[model samples]
Target: MVEADTTLAQVLRSNLMLTGTKIGCNEGQCGACSVLIDGKVVRSCAMKMRRIKDGATITTIEGIGTPEDLHPLQVAWIVHGGAQCGFCTPGFIVSAKGLLDSNPSPSREDVRNWFSRHRNACRCTGYKQLVDATLDAAKVLRGEMSIEQLQFMIPEDGRIWGTKYPRPSALAKVTGTCDYGADLGLQLPEDTLQLALVQAEVSHAHIKSIDTAEAGLMPGVYKILAHKDIKGKNRITGLITFPTNKGDGWDRPILCDEKVFQFGDAIEIHPGPPNVYFKQRVAKGEETEPLFAAAG
Candidate 1:
């Protein structure tokens, strides 16, 4: 059972343990959480459980294929270098599946038009590789090309460079089985308490005061640990050295108690110019500064 206010993406990830449906830009701007809803691609993040009709079918990346019996699109994605960084790969594949399902004989321009209309964006590898892979997958689906022909084989010369080899994690990524940071975090023990930082909102400001009383009363909030609750060194040991060979003392703090230098900053920088206390003097024979000449 899902909460009425919970998003479909949240339900899929938290309740159903379908981490393949990423929760990116939950406002529906990024298509990372895309899934097929009733045979049409829909942003899962923007869709709430309350809005879903009964018995409506949904298909995520996991439903598309498996590692052993991979879909043609997944195979093409690997061989054609369609996935890089891999975060956006699932969305692209799901969206592509929707397009291919609707129009299996789509032209190259049609593929481009489909992606543009769906707003399936990929940041790592350019769209050329993705389009190429989609077109090739379409051919395979049409029985014009065999999957074996598209599979990569090692060169006879034993040289792997400049050859098309699938990325080591490509299968996991394209299949939506790869565990990203957020995905791994979900596997932690139920007793694990999540930490959220109370970051500064302004670029620079003096912290007049902080009141955690109201927030502490909120249910499910275990504790609001302030800087004062810290046990040992409240700052990170500053190892940075100046040109004069002096170590910067306590410059990098673990928590800011007094002031903030920038937004989301936990450490406060010392006021004034950066660590270099003295101006560098260029040494020329006799044209150098009197201090440098005298030192020589």
Candidate 2:
């Protein structure tokens, strides 16, 4: 029960820890805080407790479904890619549920018309995927189709996952707006060090000597990490997941202190600018490469 002047959104989010009821543009302008009150969707942020009747039951995001047993709309959201960044997903789902309960057979235009009255805001995904998800979920609710039938109902040959449903990011990839790991460098702090790969030239070797006295003076190179710098056990441990190989996982190196081990085992790593410019800056590495054939 809420106080007389308290908005349902305030009590649900701040007090009850229901952060799914997002608070956005809090003047009933954006319906991100929409909740079901007596089976009708109302913007919880704008509707005060005084307006709600005493006996009216409220249904929140938690009421509809849980993480264990997700609502069909929630499932449809992921399968259909209705949620991107997912700030407005809860409100959209609650509103769609309310719409389906009242009219299960809503047409495409019916979906468009209903959303025109009940406001919701999504900055990331354009409303096309939202409409697709709602309509798809409506099909399930109306008993015309099953959720799994819509999702992974491939031929019984069992060779494929789905019938080539394009991912939601396909358009974004084509438009060149999709963010990649290297692209995120712009968002990182200016002082953050970027790691660039510097491969050891030797193919097979025991690392007898290393000369980095001049390489340390290179521009933009903050520091270098080698096997000597490691403070703990060199080999990674504790990942034996089977009964047969329970305690035998000491077969790798953090850094090859005396041996190169393989063709691509990581050797000396330096923290510097992630570019070819940093490559030219390092001093020449002169070392002995000893080759020995493995004997079974």
Candidate 3:
């Protein structure tokens, strides 16, 4: 049983613990939480528990296939390199399953139009592989291709390059059995503290004070950590690529303490002291001229 305000995505993920249905942009702008409701694809994040009709057949990514007895779509996804990072794979797979269930012989354009219409955004794999995978899955459903054909063979030299050997985790990813970061919450202790960021609203300003008394009074409010709460230097110290950074690597603050440098800056931290960490001089002249000079 779920509250009226609970979204279908929340019901599937939090209540039922069927985390295969992912939630990205929970406002429904992103189709990451897409699932099938009575064989029709719908963004689960947009669906509310109260709005669901009684006895309506809801199909999440888990219902489509399994690690054992994998679906054609999952196999094709592995072969076509359809998912990288795999956050958006389940949504696409569910959407594609819905399409193939209705129209088994959809063209590439049809697949493209369907994803475009549904706004199934993917940050990885460039999307071409998704269409390719879906098309091949359609062929398998239509009996034009065998599922075994998707398997890659190891060459005599054992060089897997240029071959389509699926990643060890690919099957889990496509089948929605893989555990992502958000899914880790299922295994976390009930008393574990969850963190939320409090960002700076203005681009630049001296932080007079952050009033957390009202928020601290709210129930279940464990602790409110500010810069003052940090015992050590509240900075991200590392010169990743900037060899000529003024503060070496101590410039970037973990939490902005005194002044806000930009909007959305984490509320604690500040820039480092004014001193050139590294300096190099390049002289342009004849063969006798110094090509390089350094000062630190």
Candidate 4:
């Protein structure tokens, strides 16, 4: 019954030791830590360990297939140049697995949409190769082509058209024996600490002041930190600023300075049990109310 709030990424890397799941951006925007949770793909970095405490099954790259028994998707990736550098391979493989699991015979458009919107592959391999690879893998999985036939399909010119050889992990991946980073149910001691960001209440407002007295005194609340508490470099890299229709300059803050330029900017850090902090934020209030309320 070990249960403490923890980051999914930390659990995967430290406890599961499945380093194949790369951590591109700690934020959920990047698909680097993408893994299937209960058969649905989710970004691990945004997922809190406490959210899945009921023992939901998780699947990471390791769970899909192995070098000896590669999944069809793996085989196609190699044959079609769907992978290069390989940092994003695990994510792509997992996503492709999800797509194939639901729709074993996906159309070209399906493959394009699945990869384009969900898995953010920045490698510039382009979708044409990926789509072709997925289709090829689907054919192989359906037993429409033999491994030997696939081998002869490869062109001698070294183009990403055809190749043969069973993906080493294909059998294991289809059998559901492979373990991905997300498959790990890393248990945390009951006393492990957790943290959540406390966003600002108003857009384009300065830090008039923060009243953490009541929150700090609340049960299970450990600490409340502001921008001043940031020890390391405060700015974010690779930032892009653009203009909005309102003619207002839309300059996003990689890390919020004292002034908040947007509505959902993170303003503070509330360290404690993850559940407790999240619940507090979800609670309805003037300053702490959610930006969007569900309709009845």
User: Which numbered prediction scores highest in TM-score against the true structure?
Assistant: 3
lDDT of candidate 4 over 1-296, digit per residue (tens)? 21244567656765556666767776777687788899988888777766874778889888887766667777677666666545667777888888888899999999888877775564656667668878888898889986555442536676653445335553433333344543432245545667667776777887667676877786787887865676765654323334433433333444476578777788777678745754665674311222222322
Instruction: List model 1 lDDT by residue over 1-296, tens digit each.
Output: 65665677877786678888776676788789999999999999888778889899999999999898899999999998888888888999999999999999998899998888877888888799999999999999999999988778888998788889778999998899999988987787745655546667888888788777766654566656777777787766655545563545665457777778678875322211211111112232311222111111
Quote each prediction's TM-score: 0.76, 0.52, 0.82, 0.52
What lDDT does candidate 4 reach at residue 41? 84
Off by over 4 Å in 3: 208-220, 268-296
Ranking by TM-score: 3, 1, 2, 4
Tens-digit per-residue lDDT, 244-279, candidate 3: 776667666777877787899897322221111011
lDDT of 2: 0.69
Name the best candidate (by lDDT).
3
lDDT of each: 0.78, 0.69, 0.79, 0.66
* Superior candidate under TM-score, 1 versus 3: 3
Better of 1 and 2 by TM-score: 1
Candidate closer to the true structure by lDDT (higher is better), 2 or 3? 3
lDDT of 3 at 215: 56
Give model 2 RMSD, 1 decimal.
19.3
Q: Residue pairs in steric clash, candidate 2?
A: none
